[model samples]
Target: MKRVWIAVALLLAVLAGTLSHSFYLNSFTQELTGLLEAAEAKAEQNEWASAEELTQLAHHKWDEKTAYLHILLRHSETDEVYTSFREVAEFIQCQEGGEYSAANARLIAELELLAEAEQLNLKNIL
Candidate 1:
C-alpha cells in the first residue's frame, strides 16, 4: 500500500542518516584522539611548545564542530569535553606533566566514549 511504502521510505532515510552521523563521529573522535596523544607524547619529551600547539589545534577543531555536536549530542556530554579541553590547556600552561597527562587521557577517553555512545548498536536501540 502507499502508506506502507511511505513508512519504509521514512525508516530507510532515518537509518541512512544515523549511519552517516555515526561514521562522521567515529572519524572525528579518532582525529581528536590522535592529536591529544601526539600532544601527550610531546609533553612527555618536555616539548611544551609543540604540545601546547597540538592541544590548541585539537581544541579549535572541536570548537568548529560544536554546533553540529550540540545538535546530535546532549549538551552535558559536549560541555564535559569543552571543560576537559580547558583543564588540559591550563595544565599545559603550568607545565604540569602529571596533571596534563591525566587530563589529556581523560579528554581522549571522553571523546571515544562519546562516539561509542552515538553508534547504532543494539544497546543504543534499546
Candidate 2:
C-alpha cells in the first residue's frame, strides 16, 4: 500500500508538471505571435523602423525563454523557430514587404503549432 501511494504521488507530480508546461508554452507563443503580427502590420504601412523594432523585441523575448524552451521542447522544433526569426529579421531589414509578410506568417504559424503540439489532449496521448 505504501509503495502504491508513492507511485501515485509521482504520477500526479508528472501530470502537474506537464499541464504547467503546456500552459506556459501556450502563453509564450501567443505573446510572441502578437508581437510579430504587430510588426507585420507596421511593415504593411511602410513603417520599416517600427517594424524592425517590434521584430527585435519579439526576438529578444524568444531568446529570453531559450533555456526554458530548450529543456521542454525538441531542439529541432526550437531551431526552426530560430531560423524563422532570422529570416523575418532579414526581410524586415531589406524592407521587402512581401517577403517579410511571408516570413512573419511562417513564424507565427510555427509558434501556434508549437503551442498546439504541447497541449494536453486525448489526440496527443495516443
Candidate 3:
C-alpha cells in the first residue's frame, strides 16, 4: 500500500509539471502570435513605423519570457524563436512584405508545435 501511494504521488507530480509547461508555452505563444499578427497587419497597410514598433514590442516580450522559459523548455526551441524574431525585425526594417509575412507564419507554426510537444498526452507520456 505504501509503495502504491508513492507511485501515485510521483505520477501526480509529473502530471502537474507537464500541465504547467503546456499552459505556459501555449499562453506565451498566443501572446506572441497576437503581436506578430498586429505587426503584419500594420505592414500590409504600409504603416512601417507602427510595424517596427510592434515587432520590437514582440521581441521585448520574447526576451522577458526567455529568462524563465530557458529553465522549463528545450533550449533549441527557444533558440528557434529567438532567431525568428531577429529575421522578422530585419525584414520589417527593409519593408520586405513577402519575407516578413513568411517569417511570421513560420514562427507562429513553430510556437504552436512547441506548446503541443509539452502537453500531457498519451504520446508525450509514452
Q: Give the alpha carbon lDDT tens digit for every residue of 1-126 in model 1.
A: 999999999999999999999999999999999999999999999999999999999999999999999999999999999999999999999999999999999999999999999999899889
Residue range with the least summed lDDT across 10 consecutive positions in model 2: 93-102
The residue-by-residue lDDT of candidate 3 on 17-45, one tens digit each, is 87787887889888888888898899999
Q: Which order, best to worst by lDDT?
A: 1, 2, 3
Per-residue alpha-carbon lDDT of candidate 2 for residues 21-92, written as tens digits (9 for 90 to 100): 999999999999999999988999999999999999999999999999999899999999999999999998
Q: Rate the local accuracy (lDDT) of all candidates.
A: 0.97, 0.95, 0.87
lDDT of 1: 0.97
Best by lDDT: 1
Q: What is the lDDT of residue 95 in candidate 3?
A: 90
Q: For model 3, which pairs clash?
A: none
Q: In model 2, what is the error at residue 1, expressed in angstroms?
A: 0.6
Q: Model 2's lDDT to the true fold?
A: 0.95
